[model samples]
Target: MPKKVTITDIANLVGVSKATISYYLNGNTHKMSLETREKIRQTIEATGYQPNKIARSLVTKDTKTIGVVIADITNPFISSVIKGITDTCTSKGYTVTFTNSDNQEEIEQENIARLKQQNVSGIIIDTVDANSPNISQLAFDKTVMVDRQAKKLRLDTVVSNNRESTVNFLREMKKAGYQEIYFVSFPIEGISTREMRYQGFMEEVTEDSSHLLILEEPGVEKRIYDLIQKAKDKIAFFTMNGPTLLAFMKIVNKTSFRYPEDFGLGSYEDLAWMDVLNPNVSCIRQDSYQIGVLAARHLLAKLKKEKSSSSPKLLVVPSESVIRNSF
Candidate 1:
C-alpha cells in the first residue's frame, strides 16, 4: 500500500517547512507569497494530499466545520436551505455537516450530540423547538437558528413574516368573494415555522364556524375527500408545507374538485412538481436559500470572534405572494 502522506511529506517534497504548509492549509497566510501558495496548491492536487482539518484545528482551535441541522431534507424548502448553507460555507473555507431531524426531538438531540463530539466550530440549526432546553445545551462557540427563533437563549435567529404573509393571502381570498377558508398542516409540536404560520392564519380568520377548518395528520385520500365534501360552494384552502400540498393535490385530482370554482388552494413551500400541475397553485414564497446563506454567514461571523451587540437578534426576511388560478 502507498504510504499515507502528512504535512511533513508535502513540506519535504515542496522544499518548505512544515509550519509554512500548515499556515497555507489553515488559511492563515501572513507573509507567504502568492507564488508559494500556488506551488503548494499544485503539489497538493498532484499528490492527492488532503489536509486533516481536525488535526489542524487542534493547533488553530478552529474546525472550519459548521453543523447544519434541518427538520426534513426531503422537503423542497429544506433542500433549498441546505443548498444555501453548503454554498455559503464552502465559499468561506468551511464545510457543512448535515443531519435531518425528521421532526423528532430525540433524533435532533442525538445528532447535536454527534456534532458536539465532532467539535464542530458552530451550528446553523432549523430546530423543532424555539424554547427547548436542548438548544441552550448545545453550548457551541456559535449557534444560529434558521427559520426559528430562540428568544430565551442568546442565539442568532432568522425567520420570515409568517403571520403577515398568511394574513395577506387570506385577505386576498376574502376580497375575491371567498366566504370559507380552510388551513391544513402537518402535526405541529414545537416547530416554530408551522406554529407561526398557524398564528398568521388565525389572525385573519374569525371564530365563525364556517370561516375556518384546520386539519392535522390527515391521510391523503381523507384530506381530499374532506375538502371535496366540505368545500360547499367557494373553497379556499391554505396548506402549510409541500407534503401537505402534494397529498391534497392527489385528492384534488381524484375527486374532480375544479380549481377556483369548487376549491381554491394556496400552498407554502412550493414543491418541485407544483408548477407542472394542471392549475399551478398560488403560493407564499420564502427565500429559503437566502435564509440558509444568511444563517451560515451569521455563524461564521460569530466564529470570527466579531463583537455584536445584544440586540433582539431575530432576522425576519420578507416574503412575497405568488398568485395563480387557485387563488
Candidate 2:
C-alpha cells in the first residue's frame, strides 16, 4: 500500500511552514497571502492529505461533529427532520452521530450517555419525555431540544406552532357545522407537543373530558363506535398526530362509518398517505424538516459562540392548514 500523506509532506511540497498549513486547515487564511494559500491548497490536493480529526480535536477541543438522539426513528415526520439535519450538517462541513430512543425514557438516557462518552461537540435530542430528570442534567449551552420543551429547564427548543395551528383547524371544522369535536390522542402524559395540540383543540371546542378519546384506554374502539352511534348533532374527530390518526382510522375503518357523511375528520399531522385516501383527510401540516434545520443551526450558533442570548429561547416554526374533503 502507498504511504498516507501528512500535513508535513504537503508543507514541504508547497515550500511553506507547517504553521501556514495549519492556519489554512483551520480556515485562518487571512494570516497568509492569496498566492501562498493557493500553493498550499494545490499541494494538499495533489498529495491527498487527510487531517487526523482526533489529534486536531485534542488540540482545539472541538470535534466538529454533532450528536443526535431521536425519540422515534420510525416516524416519517422525524425521518424528514433527520434528512434536513444531515443535509445542513454536510453543507457546513460537520459530521453527525445519530441514536434512536424508540420512545423509551430509559433508552433515551442511555443514548444520551453514550453520545456524551463519544465526546461529541454538541447534541440535538428529540426527547421521549421532556420532564425526564436526565434532560435537566444536560449541558444547557451545548444541547438543543427538538419537538419537545421543558419550561423549567429553560433549554433552547424548536417546535411547531401546535396550539395556534390546532385552534385554526378546529375553528374551520366548527365553521363547517361540526356541533361537537372530539380530540383523539394516544396519551398526553406531560408531552409538550401533545399537550399543546390538546390545549389548542380545547380552546376551539368547549367540551368536557368525555370528548377526549385516549387510544390506549381499554374498550376505546367500542367507546368510539358508541359515540358515533349516539350522536344527535353533526360531530367530528380531530387527531393529535400521524400515528394517533392512523390508530383512530383503524378503529373507525372496522365500522361502516364514513367521513363528512357520518362524521367529519381532521388531524394535526399531514402525512402523504392521508392525501391518497378516497376523500383526502384535511389536516394541519407542520414544517418538521425546517424545525430540524433550525435546531441544528441554533446548536451550531451556540457551539461557535455566535449566539448572544443568555436565556434559552423557544423558537416556533409555523404550520399550514391543508384543507381537504374530509372536513
Candidate 3:
C-alpha cells in the first residue's frame, strides 16, 4: 500500500530546507525569492499536494474559513443566496460554516458570537435585526452583509435596490390604472429589508398613508377579509416577500376575488411558484444568487486585505419588474 505524501517529502524532493516550504505554505512566499516561490508552486501542483488547512491555521492563528448566517433558511429566496455563497467560497478554497437564525434577532446575535468563537476568517450575514450594535461593530472588520442591510453601517453590504426599484415599479402599476394600491407586509419592527421595501412603496404613494397594511399572523384571515371589503375596483396590492405573498394568496383564495380586472398583485420575490399561478404573478425578479456571490467576494476581499474602504459602502444590485397578467 502506498503512503500519503507529506510536506517533508516535498522539501526533500525539491532539495530545500523544510522551513522554506513551511514559509511558503504559511503565505510567506515574499520571504523567499520569486524563483523559489514559483518552483515550490510548480512542484506542489505536480505532486497534487494539498495543504493541511487545520495545521496551517494553528500556525497562522487564523482559519481560512468563512461563517455565514441567514435569517430564514426555509425561505426559497434565501436558500439560493446561500448556494451562491458556498459555490464561490469553495472555488476560492475557503471553508464555509453557516447558521440559520429563523427570523429571531437574539438567535442572530448568538450565531454571530458562535462564528467569532470558531475563529473564522470572515462573516456574511442576512440578518433578522440589522439595528443591533453588535452588527455594526462586526461591520468595521471581518463581516459583510447580504440581502437585508443595516440602516446605519460601517461595513460592506450587497443588496437588491429595494427602495428605488419598488418605487419605480409601483409607479408603473399606478400608470397602468391601479386606483387603490396597498403595501402589504408582514411587520415593520425595524427590520431593514421590510423597512426599505416599505419605504419604496411610500415614495411612489404620495396620497393617503392609510394604504399601508400590516399582515398579523393571528386573525390574518379575518384581517384579509376586512381588507378585501375595503378594496375598490382596480385595487392593486404589493407584498414585501415571497412568504408574505403566499399568505396573501391564501386569503385571496378564501373568496371569489379575481386579479387585474378586480385586483392587481405584485410581490418582491419572484419565486418559482409564481410562474404556476393562473394569471402569471407580476413581481420583482432579484438576482438573489448574484447578491450572495457579490457579498462573499467582498468578504474575501477584506480577509485577503485587498480592500481599501474604511467607511461602509452599500453595493446595490439591480432588479427587474417581471410584468405579467397579474398586474
Candidate 4:
C-alpha cells in the first residue's frame, strides 16, 4: 500500500513548521505571506493530505460538526428540510451528524443526549414535543429548534408562518363561498404547529369545538359524514398537515362525497402528490427547506458568538398559498 501523507509531510515538503500547516488548514492565514500560502496549498494538493478531524478537534475543542435530530425522516417535507440543512452546512465547511426520532419523545431526548455526548459543536432539532420538561432544561446557547416552539421560548426557533398562512387560506375558502368550514387534525395535544394553525382557523370560523374534527377520535368518519349531510350551506374542510390531510382524504374517499361538489377541501401542506390528485388540492405551502437552512444558520451564528441577542429569537419563514380547484 502507498504511504499515507500527513500534515508533517506537507510541512517538510514546503520547508514550514507543523504549526504553519495547521494554521493554513484551519483557515487562520492572516499572518502567513501570500507566497507561503500558495506553496502550502500546492503541496497539500500534490500530496492529497487530509487533516485528522479527531486530532484537530481534540486540540481546538471544535468538531466543526453539527448534529441534527429529525422528528420523522420518512416525511417528504422533512426530507426537503434535511436537504437544505446539509447543503447549507456543506457550503460553510461544516458536516452534519443526524438521528431520526420517529416522532417519539423519549427517542428525541435520547438523540439530543447522544449528540451532546459526541461533543458536536451545535445541534438542530425538529422536536417531537417542544414543550417537554426535558427540552425546557436544555442549554439554548448552542441549540436551535426547527418546526416547533417551546412554550417558554428559551431557544432559538425557526418555523413557518403557521398562524398567518392558515388564516389567509381560510379567508380564501370563505371568499369561495364555503359557509361552514371544519378544521381537521390528529390532535392539538400542545403541539405548537397544530395549535397555531387551529388558532388561525378559529379566527374566521365559529369557535365551537364541534367544528373541530379529531382524526384519532372514535366515529370521526361518521361525524364528518353527518356534518356534510346536515350542513345548511356549502361546507369545506381544512386539514392541519400532510399526514392529517391524507387521513382525512382516506376517510372522505370511502364515502360517496367528492370535492368541490359534495364538499370543498383545502389543506396546510402543499405536497407534490397533492398536485397530481384529481382537481389538485389548494393549500398553504410552507418553505420547509428554508426553515432548515435558517435553523442551521442560526445555530452557526450562536456557535460563532455573532448573535447578540441573549433572549430567545423566533424566526418565522413566510409560507405561500397555492390556490387550486379543490376549494
- Could you tell me the C-alpha RMSD of candidate 4 in Å? 1.7
Give candidate 2's root-mean-square deviation (CA, Å): 1.8
Which 10 consecutive residues of model 1 have the lowest summed lDDT?
209-218
Indicate the TM-score of model 4. 0.94
Model 3 lDDT tens row, 234-274: 77889998999998888788788777656888999899989
TM-score of each: 0.80, 0.94, 0.92, 0.94
Name the TM-score of candidate 3: 0.92
lDDT of 1 by residue, 1-327 (tens): 998788899999889999999989877777999889989998999899988876888998888889888776766677888898899999988888999999888999999999988888898888877788878786544788888775464576888888788888788888877777777776655667777788787788764533344444335456556656766567678888778787666656776667776777888766657777777878888888888888888788878877465544777777888877776
Using TM-score as the measure, the top candidate is: 4
Total backbone collisions, model 3: 0
Decoy 1 TM-score against native = 0.80
Q: For model 3, state the Cα shift of residue 258 in Å.
A: 1.5
Candidate 3: segments with Cα more than 4 A from true spot: 31-35, 136-139, 217-233
**Model 2 lDDT tens row, 213-305:** 999999989989998899999989999998998999899999899897999999998899999998999999999989989999999989888
Output the lDDT of residue 151, model 3.
63
- Candidate 2 residue 31 Cα shift, in angstroms, is 3.2
- Return whichever of 3 and 4 wins on TM-score: 4
* Model 4: per-residue Cα lDDT over 108-217, one tens digit each: 88888899899999888888888887676567888889898987897889989998999999999999999999999988978999999998988878789989999999
Q: List candidate 2 segments past 4 Å from native.
A: 1-3, 45-48
Instruction: Name the lDDT of candidate 3.
Output: 0.84
